[model samples]
Target: MTIDSVRGAPEPELVQLLTPEGERVEHPDYPLDVTAEELRALYRDLVVVRRIDLEAVALTRQGELGIWASLLGQEAAQIGSGRALGEHDMVFPTYREHGVAWCRQVEPLNLLGLFRGVNHGGWDPAEHGFHLYTIVIGSQTLHATGYAMGMQRDGVLGTDRAGATIAYFGDGATSQGDVNEAFVFASVFNAPIVFFCQNNQWAISEPLERQTRIPLYKRAQGYGFPGVRVDGNDVLACLAVTRKALKDAREGQGPTLVEAFTYRMGAHTTTDDPTRYRLKAEEESWKLKDPIERVKAYLVRNQLADTSFLDEVDAEAKQVATALRKACLDLPDPRPLAMFEHVYAEPHPLMTEEQERFAAYLASFEEASA
Candidate 1:
């Protein structure tokens, strides 16, 4: 994957295609080799992701969900890496990666339940090959590293079929100790894990400058792995770079550090206010790089779609939001006792006592005989 270096530098050019206005450009070395169908599929992925993001935010406003992390601008970074993943490739994601969960076929509503304070995790990670969204910053990186080491022990690396892991963390997480340690372990052991850092340029109120002085990709050099930046807003670039990284890892080429340079177009969460820390001019700047608009531009420029198609895509995005709204409002409240069903394989005395006490409390509320 590290084919050529930048002029007088050790790293290659940060690969990018598809300008903010939707012009399809090409990388000198990492030319996109996907078909038109694949390109359109990327567009579809972005549409649905944005729809889910909007809906989740609305649910939080309606008080149906406890919290929501909106990935409004980082759609391309998620979809590109997500679509590039094989079915068997395990994904370790930090919370707010709703787009990645969507790419893995996790039911959109499953996400709401977690935010609704109904359950610890809405979807089983094993079923989707996506670990439960880790709340602690950058902790999942170590989990991915350990798992990748296990994959090596299992002798799955270098096999064409399956054996790649991806750890999804935020720009802020890059500053965490575990993320750095993960890189160290992965490099020494030659673990087949892809460290995907989606640098959305904001950690709550702090800017990217607060997180790093140099481009994030440059950090990979100290760990002895290839690190490269990609235009995270460019869907094609995300897929091309991440796919190559995973492929190289699987082929025993070792780990990769992919820093997706992107922006957080929305607030950190429904509870935070960007206006307090960021400027309107800054938001306007990222708006020019809207992930959805670029794909729409591509469709129009390539004659793949017209006004009618654009209208249809809009309708679809709206329909998705409406459906999510209805579903979240009507979602059944989980049985109080259901929470105790999967806590442990072997019986835990403390869990059993808590379950019984909670069940009795629920029964008391069910009917008060007069």
Candidate 2:
């Protein structure tokens, strides 16, 4: 059954700039003026990020990674929202936010290492303005709320130099107490944050219908914050809506909940079998609304990008996949004791003692073997 049928209600109006047929439509509320160059760049971002995702899935299948969460059909929701962030803005992302990580300049290899059990996303969050992926259901929302409050206290809110924070979560996370608590805190404190929810239709096996009776975005209204639903498949609409939301937060307008209504075209992760719960026909229907293909069509229809440009993008995607594979293969396994090293900022006596004891234990193994 389609998501609309599951809701048993009419689908709410979504902010859309592009139709499934590749025709660009105008939205009075969210106006987006993009040049040909910008369009090309956005298309490139979508294509490259998708390639990286595909490669990661391939690696997992090849036993290079223990597990991987695929973002097969949520490219526009991610890349569009990711690209909307300001340079100084911070982002808290869920485990499946590889696309946002890419926009934040976190290398794909760093993500691969996390899945491979080598390290906890080797890149520093402060350096990249992107927090490490949060595997917990919805805890990152609290972290983002706290950080945004911190920014407000630091006298950064309502300024031209304001740096807003965005917390990325899925539809499933909305049900978590942590997410609800975050909304309350953000609203009461007027935290300069944007809660970007990529509602990809399924939170694992549970469909969107099971998550809530009303639409996900509307949940924000009760919390006293503005909420918007955007066509997650339309990259331009996502970009426009997110840009406005971030701008509003920076200007001290408080939190905004942006629901990017999209679908998951593949299994939730490499470990999932979508065929068991969702219908094959449903998947085929969403395929027609493919985000990348729409952008390509728009480009081709306008004669902005010819076959040569398309071929170049495909070639570039292959090169990126090659580099990512090499990087993943070259990663060295961390020593067993490495995990204890970064547990605290300053070395504590108890930790040091434990580390020594662990070292002794490891040494005893070598002695026994000898």
Candidate 3:
């Protein structure tokens, strides 16, 4: 398939609950039942998440952040799967899982602080059931697998209190040894984890064709587990598939690989330029499949949400974006010595010496200024 043809057709195996033109379709394998209220909530989530991402990208351009990984077009994939998680379910995320972070109720400013180089992800992971974002590619899958194994040992599997873990990674990560290793471990242990890969077509500057010879979901079969590809742009399909996968996992059905086939309409990150690699026409084609637009269209067409509600959502999104910007600006810079903290579980002489020396250095500057 050519670059422009990437979003042309959905494969026969692709599960899509809502079409791009605002039409709803049914999939017998992955049935979804959503109330009007739930639909409105999902629409709100899509808008607010996109707004957060837009604000972050603006902040990066304004030099408030060191850099940012924008989740421009993949909002549905994150929100859908994120909302699908049970209250007790755990998530191991990559750096770009901002939408998932939002769904987890993580402070947007906290995320900005990480990019702002203030403190190492200020929120407590145990409190949120969301692990710290992993910068190293595909390593979180291993961590999620091990955590799921621990859950199994804890004897929660197949119980009412059972919980599953979901590991979020990008398509590029599929090539990493860590990811493949994770697949092997999860399968062998029958770990209750969902390997959620958001295949956004472009892995940095390289295209999807360069990443794999077959659909990414097919790789799961080789690992002795089930794999399914879903329309990443369809929020309903993502929710249904993820919900079922998580439920099956809790029941000791082993791991499942869910490949959300989607597109990234923006640069890989604020630092990189997509124009250098992909064509503008390719991005334009994917615009027709915009995750948020489809949901809006469906809401409008079905009258589940009137214009007033749609307007209200837009206003709320703006409010969220404005608050995020203010919070980002108000974030305090960490003290020079604060870096010495959290280096290890226990204090070390080397750290103490370095801290003292750094303090002395700062004192010297003050002394000179005086």
Candidate 4:
């Protein structure tokens, strides 16, 4: 389907609270009551998250990271939804959600460790309420669904103290059977979970047309839940929509699908080349709708933040990037045998034998050197 066709007819118009020129607008269904201080904080979040993403991309090019999935244009989508989350809410993220990880108070170094080949996950998930990154496409959705069901069984639903779960995936994941199954389970059980799909225009090299003819959020209607498409570049809209969806889930209103309509400004990952499949014109058009630039413009136009504040934020971003670089380079590489250590909960004879043989092989190398 062409962009004009999708934007024109059967699908609903995108929900937006902030214009590309930085003017704030009102939404009847999704209202926001943000203070000036909170708005400034959101701007800080967008700046820092973008910096972290750019730094990771640079590090991957420098051979510090094996690969980096850059979330260049989706900062507002992530930060807005992430900040809407309550302290007890759980989040299951796909590998590219660096911005969400930041909002969860996860150290950038911990995330880098996974891509740097140091560990599967370097931090405790329970402590931060953020699960380990799932590289398998769409698998985390099922995990989030099951976790939400557990919360329901434990009588945690419909209470102020109750918490909901969020499943972060991409446009590509919506095509996966696992994600569809997750939707079925969540709907039938009336589970308190939010399915946040960041439709970044392209899923790898494939255009969104390859995924579905209809807008993705519309799929939720068939499964018996409400779905809304929001201007992912507009942080205010994303924040308002997500906060409302999450609140509904907490009140036992059931699952909601939040389609964050945004763009992927960079390649799918450090290794891929967008030039191979996408046009330069398309990229240029998105530059004008950049998430960070609009937020910065809004802050300046309203005098909520001055030049000195912006300069300070920029300096702070530089420090964060520098620290991330140092942490990535300083990480210790795991031993070859470390991979087999967690293969099973209890020791097995075959694994034991393999470990022994591997140890003997290393010993022989030392003996020869000596």
CA lDDT, every prediction? 0.86, 0.93, 0.93, 0.93
Residue-by-residue lDDT tens digits, candidate 4, 1-370 = 5743775765577899999999999999998999989998999999999999899999999898999999999999999999999987999999999999999999999988999988878878899999999999999999999999998888978776799999999999999999999999999999999999999989899899889878899999999999999999999999999999999998889999999999999999999999999999999999999998898898899989999999999999999999989878998989978978878999999999999999899899999999
Off by over 4 Å in 2: 1-9, 349-357
Model 1, range 59-150, lDDT digits (tens) per residue?
78878898899999999999999988897799999988888898999988888878886777888888998999898999999999999888
Worst 10 residues of 4 by lDDT: 2-11
In model 1, the runs with Cα more than 4 Å from the true position are 1-13, 356-370
Better of 1 and 3 by TM-score: 3
- Cα deviation of 182, candidate 3, in Å: 0.2
Taking all chains together, the TM-score of candidate 2 against the true structure is 0.96
TM-score of every model versus the real structure: 0.91, 0.96, 0.96, 0.96
Residue pairs in clash, model 3: none
Least lDDT summed over 10 consecutive residues: which range in candidate 2? 1-10
**Per-residue lDDT for 1-370 in model 3, tens only?**
7532466745438899999998999999898889999999999999999999999999999999999999999999999999998887999999999999988999988999999999899898888989998999999999999999999999999888899999999999999999999999999999999999999988898888888877889899999999999999999999999999999999999999999999998888999999999999989999999999999999998889898998999999999999989988999888888898889899899889989999999999999999
lDDT of 4: 0.93
lDDT (Cα, tens digit) per residue for candidate 2, span 1-370: 5555454778788999999889999999899999999999999999999999999999999999999999999999999999999977999999999989989889889999999999977898999999999999999999999999999888976676789999999999999999999999999999999999999989999988788878889889999999999999999999999999999999889999999999988888899999899899989999999999999999999999999999999999999999999999999989999979778899899989999999999999999999
Which of the two, 2 or 4, has more TM-score? 4
Error of 3 at 213 (Å): 0.5
